[model samples]
Structures are given as structure tokens and as C-alpha cells.
Target: MSLVGIHGVSLRYGDRQVISRVSLQIETGEFFVIIGPNGAGKTTLLKALSGLHPLIEGDIQIRQRPIGDYTKKELARTLALVPQQVNADFPFTVAETVLMGRYPHLGLLAVEGKRDLELAEQAMEFTEVIHLAGRRLGQLSGGERQRVIIARAICQQSEILLLDEPTAFLDPAHQLRIMDLMERLRLREKITIVMVSHDLNLASTYADRLLLLKDGTVENIGTPREVLTREQLTKSYGCTLLVDENPLLGTPRVSLVSEKVAATISKDSGEL
Candidate 1:
């Protein structure tokens, strides 16, 4: 069964519908990327899938059961969300922050047990933040803080993870590192991952599948090789698109070419 499936899901703010009848499925063990221009509801769709926003219409299912049917605790156990930014001010150590993931398993007045601590430690180790376990959240750099938050989500031990623009503030190198780390974790744990990314080329390289959205509607869903054609991206972004395999990565990449450049390239290839 699919780890997560959305059947005509919709979300609205006041009277303006942000997500309109979006249908998609994230199979188990797949890294799925959702890409669209700004105001296309990519983050809104991620929020709806994470159950942070109530659905305005249609239904979503997790493991064959209705998403809305899951209790808060159950939902917490099934999926974990890693937001793009964190404004944490607590003096708690990184380990303590990660241990918070075990709240759903803890009793009302009980503290985290040894098993919980161990799990949190392992998550830190995997995310390469073990050395920062004792540092305060306010003391870490932006990339380090991002890693700690991701470790916290990893400690949640959920089968599905939803991330919204995970590489927002990092430098280009660290951004690629974070994405690579997430892809590795998903493979190692057989976890289904869904992320919103503005970097279409990185999304193409890492995601096993891509879902493209346009104006709150599903534009296309397929492998990056299929959905990331020059025509599709050009029309979606209202800009010239240049699709080609990266010489270094040997995978598809998207470039925002100027109209003049695109016309020249297109005519050279006899496409125009």
C-alpha cells in the first residue's frame, strides 16, 4: 500500500481556495519532490498533508486509512514535519531538543526513558550532529540548527516525513549536503519523503518522482525525466526553460534561459 495518498485534497484560507483538488500518491521508500512557482500552493499542500491545516474538501489517506481519522497522537506517530525555519530560544541542549520527539510515547508526568534517549542519540549520530548535543540552540549556526531540527524529526520514528523548503537559508554546498542526507536516511529507513523545493535541478537529481503544481492544481506527476521538459517548465514559470543533463551529475537539470537564448537554442535544435 502507498505510504501516503491524497485523493482530491483541498485547502482554503477564508474564501480563497489555496489547494484545489490535488491528487497524488507517495509510495513507500520513494523520495518525492513537489515543485512549483511561488503562490502555487506547494507549502499549502505540504501543510495539508502534515495535518497541520484542516482540509476544506476531499480526503487523504495514510496507510489506507483516512488522514483525518487519525488521532493527533496517531498522526504524530505516523508522520513528522520539518519546517523550513525554527525560532527556538530555549537553552536546552540539542539532545534535549531531539528527545522531544518522544513526547507522543511518554506518559503525562513521566520523563523520557533510556530507550528514548538512545533513539535520540542515534538520530543525532546519523545526522552528524552528535557533537552538538550539548550546545544551546541559540549557539549554533544556521546549517547546524537545521541539522538538529532534522535530527529531532528523525527521532520521531515515523514512516512518512514532510519537509517544506528544507534548504532555505544554507549556502549552496550545505543545501546540497542536507538534501543528500535526507535522501540517504530515506533509503536506509525505507521512509517515504515528500519535500517542497525551489531548486528544480536538485529535486530532479534526488527525488525518485516529481509532482508539479500550477495555481493550486496538479500540473503533472511523473519521473523527473518525464515531467521536467522544457515546454512544461517554461509554461509553468512563464520564462524561458533550458532542460539538459548536467555534465557532472549525468542527470536532468533545469535552467532559466533568457528568451533570446532559448530561441537560439531551440532553433539550433530545430524545435522552434
Candidate 2:
């Protein structure tokens, strides 16, 4: 059975439909990515999977059980979500923040035990945030804070990890670092990853399969090669795009064609 089943799911904010009958199955240990232009409901869909957003249409299932069936604590123990923007205004230490992931497993008013500390330590070590354990979250860089957030999610010890634009504002090095860490966790811990991203090349490189949404609808869903075609992207993004091969990873590489470049090519081809 698939780890997650999103069947005919549709969601809305009041009367405006934001996710339209989107159906997809995510398998165990798969690195699945959702990509689209802005306002395409990528983040909304991710929230639906995490049971944060209620569906106006169909249902979502985790392990063949309806998402709504799980209690709040049960859902927290089953799925961990790392949103795009984290509130790090508080003066919580990195270690303290990471240890919060274990709250779902603790009894009422219970303190963290040795096992909780060990898990948190392992999570921090795996994400390479152990060195910053003593530092406050508000004192860390964007990259460092991002890693700490991911470490907290890892510390949750959930079977599924959902991320929303985890690399949105990081530098290239940090972006790659986060993606590589996610890949390592997928392979080593067998954690299922469901991420929403705007970076097509990064999605193609790491995702076992990609789901492309356009105007709150599923435009395409398949392997990167099948979904990242020039025609589909041009249609969905409403702009010219160049699709080519990534020499290093042999995955599809997508490049945006600016208006001037596109016009130049059109003029050379006698289409202008």
C-alpha cells in the first residue's frame, strides 16, 4: 500500500477553490516533490497532506486510514511538517527547540527522558547542527536556522516529512546542503519526503517523481523527464522555457528564456 493517498482532494479558502480534485499516491521512502508557479496551491496541497487544511471535496489517507481519523497527537507523531517561514523570534536554544519535537510522545507534564535526549542528539548530529546546540535560534544565520528546523522535524521521529519551500531564501551552497541532507535521510532512515518547491532543477534532480500544479490543478505527474518537458512548462508557467539535460545527474535541467532572448531566437528563426 502507498504511504499516502490523496484521492480527489479539493480545498478552498471560503468560496475560492485553491486545490482542485488533486489525486496522487506517495510511496514509502519516496522523495516526492510538488512544483508550480506562485498561486498554484503548492503550499496548500502540502498543508492538506499534513491535515492542517480541511478538504472541501475528497479525502486524504495515511496508511489507509483517513487523515481526519487521527487525533492531534497521533497526527503529530505520524507526520512532521517544516514550513517555509519559521518564527525564531524567541530566545530558545537550538537544543531546547529540537527537544520540543518529543512533546507529542511525552505524558502530561512529563519531562524529556534519556531516550528523548538521545533522539534529539542523533537528529542534531545527523543534520550537522550539533555544533550550534548551545546557540540561540535568533542568533543563527538563515542557513543554520533552516538546518535546525529540519533537525527538529527529524527529532519528531515521524514516518513522513513535509516541507514547504525549505530552501527559499538560502544561498546556493546552503540550498544544496539542505537537499543533500534530505536525500541522505531518505536513504538512510527510509523517511518519506514530500516537499513543495519552486526550483525546477532541484526538484528534477532529487525527486523520484514530480507533481506539477497549475492554477490549483494537476498539470502533470510523472518522473522528472516526463513532467519537465518544454511544452508543459511553457503552458503552465505562461512563459518560454528551455529544457535540457543535467550533465552531472542526467536529470532534466530547466532554464527560463527571457523575453529578449526568446525574441532573438524567434527573429533568427523568421517567426518574428
Candidate 3:
């Protein structure tokens, strides 16, 4: 069965329709990436999948059951969402923050047991944040905080992970590290992951499949080669794009074609 299924889903905020009748299915144990230009409802779609926003139309199912049927705590046990940014003014320690992920599993008025502590520590180690366990969350850098948040999600022990712009503020090295970590976890645990990113190259590199959104609808959905074609991308993004193979990974590489350069090439070719 598909891990997630969305059918004719639409969402709106007041008079603004952010998502149109979009539908897609995500298979279990696959790495999926969602990509699009700004205001294409990439984040909104992620939010809808996470059940943070109620759908105005259609239905979403996880594991053959309706998503809305799961209670918040029940849902937390099945999926976790890592947002683009997280901020906190309180002086919570890194360990404390990570321990919160276990809330969904804890009994009423219960405290962290030996297994829970071990799980939290293991998650911290996986994300390389164990050394900073004593540090205050408010004092960490953006990259550090991002890792901490992911560690917390790992501690949640969900089968599916949803991430939005996970590499936004991180440097290149850290970005690779985060992706590598996620890939490793997914492989080892048979977890399913869906990420929303603007980095086409990164998406092409790691995603098993890509979903391209345009104006709140699916423009394309397929392997990188099929979805990242120049014709499809140009129509979806409303701009001329150059598509080529990435020399290292043999996946589709996308480049923006400047109008000035195109015009010059056109004139030179015409004069020949």
C-alpha cells in the first residue's frame, strides 16, 4: 500500500486559494522531493500532508486510513515534520528539547524511562548533536538548531518524515551532511521521506521521484529525467531553462537561460 495518498486535495485561506485539486501517491520506503517556484504551494502541500492544515476539499490517507482520523498523538507516532526554521527564547537544554519527541509514547503523567533516554541519546548521536546535549537551544547556531530539530524527529520514531527547505541556512558541507544522514536513516530503518526544496540539483541527486508544482497544481511527477526536461520545466516555471545531465550523478541538471544570451546566440546564428 502507498504510505501516503492525496486525492483531489484543495486548500484555501480566507479568499485566497493556496492549493488546487492536487493528487499524488507516495510509496513506502522511497525518498520523494517536491519542487517548484515561489507561491506554488509547495509548503502548503507539505502542511496539508502533515495535517497541520485542514483540506477544504478531497481527502488524504496514510496507510489506507484517513489522515484526519488519527489523533495528534497517534499521528505523531506515524509521521514527523521538520520545518525550515525553528526558534526558541526559552533556555531549554538540547537533551530536553529532544526528549520532547517521546511525548507521544509516554503514558499519562509518566516520565522518561531508561529506554526513552537511550533512544534520545541514540538520536542525538545519529545527528551528531550528542556533544551539545548540555548546551542551551537558544545559544546554538541555525545549523546546530536544525540538526537538533531533526534529532528530535528521529526520536519520534515515525515511519515517515516530512521536511521543508531543510538546507536553507546551512553551508554546503552541512547540507550534504544532513542529506546523507537522512538517506542513511531511511535505508537502515526503511523509513519514507518527503522533502520540499528549491535546489533542483540536490533534488535530482537524492530523490527517487520528483513532484513539480506550478500555481498550486502538479505540473509534473516522475523520475528526474522525465520531469526535469527543458520543455516541461519551461512550461511549468514560465521561463526558458536549459536541462542537461549532471556529470557526476548522471541525473538531470537544470540551468536558467538568460534572455540576453539567447538573443545574442540567435543573432549570431542568423548572421552566419
lDDT of 1 by residue, 149-264 (tens): 88988988998888889898889988988998888888789888999999998898898899999999999999999889888997898987778988887778887777887778
Model 2, runs deviating above 4 Å: 270-272
Cα-lDDT of candidate 1:
0.87
Residue 225 displacement (Å), model 1? 0.4
Clashing pairs in 3: none
CA displacement after TM-score superposition, residue 246 of candidate 2 (Å)? 1.1
The alpha-carbon lDDT assigned to residue 76 of candidate 1 equals 85
Per-residue CA lDDT of candidate 3, range 140-236, in tens?
9888899999999999999999999999888999999899988998899998999999988889889999999988889999998888888888788
Predicted structure 3, TM vs. truth: 0.95
Between candidates 2 and 3, the TM-score winner: 2
Q: Is candidate 1 or candidate 3 better by TM-score?
A: 3
List lDDT for all candidates, in order. Answer: 0.87, 0.93, 0.91
What TM-score goes with each of the models?
Answer: 0.94, 0.97, 0.95
- In candidate 2, the residue pairs with backbone N, CA or C atoms under 3 Å apart (3 or more residues apart, or in different chains) clash, namely none
Clashes of 1: 0
- Ranking of all candidate structures by their TM-score, best first: 2, 3, 1
